[model samples]
Target: MLNPVMNNTKWYELRLQMCALVPPPTWSTFSTAGYRSQPDREWFYHFREGGYEDILHVDIQVETPVEREIVRSALKAVHVPGEETPSGFRVFGYLHDGQGAGYI
Candidate 1:
């Protein structure tokens, strides 16, 4: 299970993709570059498939309008699972209105 020469993760290799309504404007021209530079690791949380399935809580607080829009526009809805919110996806490309599509 431990390959010293390759530390790549299962999720990163899969590179799941999702469609967003649109991206702000920095996703392609800027944020894309930043997101690619992460430590090449996967972040995950355990979910309870039983009683508290809908008990998840997320708090978002952004002070800047520009930054706020980027985070807000990331999610489509709670129905789509991974693509439910901005935190759900990664910067993939730009859309018709300079917005972006998020990939997992």
Candidate 2:
């Protein structure tokens, strides 16, 4: 009987290929109603109250699993104490490499 072995090369290659296929992250923006700006430049609002505004822009980068996990944990630790408004939260990913460089 022959045993089937999982080829991690194909998996890794596919992951790399898929990652390559995706366009690099770019700037984006969103607007919210009933949003309050703090002196520290943090905006507070609810997730459902406002729609994403095209005017507020940010650069978004594709995140790796470790990065995503770290961000998720960080978000969990953050505390926002104040009135919440809809459509408040801008998530952006950071890429260490693959920026301004030509792909093969």
Candidate 3:
């Protein structure tokens, strides 16, 4: 998706679409949380030069292969402008298929 960090409006809209297209686990939670402040490293969270508050961690859960494809398509369609993210946000997905299709 458009490096949601690039635009607030786009991010908001995309976030809504993602939630609608791919629902997360009911038991899980949504957050903009990340390790931008931590010394460790991770790809699930998009870390930028900005502060941690700028990050948005939208970890979603897809229930089916079709849903997974849609989510993946949506991610591939967006064109993120500039090398640096305006804010500090990223999208993630977890497929609960038997194969253990973890994070995306």
TM-score of each: 0.24, 0.24, 0.37
Residue 75's lDDT in candidate 2: 30
**Over 4 Å off, model 3:** 1-4, 19-55, 80-104
Angstrom error of the Cα, residue 31, model 2: value is 1.3
Candidate 3 lDDT, tens digit per residue, 1-104? Answer: 21233355544444444545424221122334433333222222332224223443443344556655675565445542212112222353222234222212
Please give, for residues 1-104, the per-residue lDDT of candidate 2 as tens digits.
21212133422332233233333222133222223332221122221124333112222223465444433333334321111112222332121243221111
Query: Candidate 2 versus the native: TM-score?
Result: 0.24
**Cα lDDT of model 1 by residue, 1-104, tens digit:** 11121112322222221122222222211121232222212222111112121222222223356645555444332212222234333322222344333422
TM-score of 1: 0.24
What candidate 1 gets wrong by more than 4 Å, as runs, is: 1-56, 77-104
Best by lDDT: 3
lDDT per model vs. reference: 0.27, 0.27, 0.37
Which RMSD values do the candidates have, in order? 16.7, 18.9, 13.0
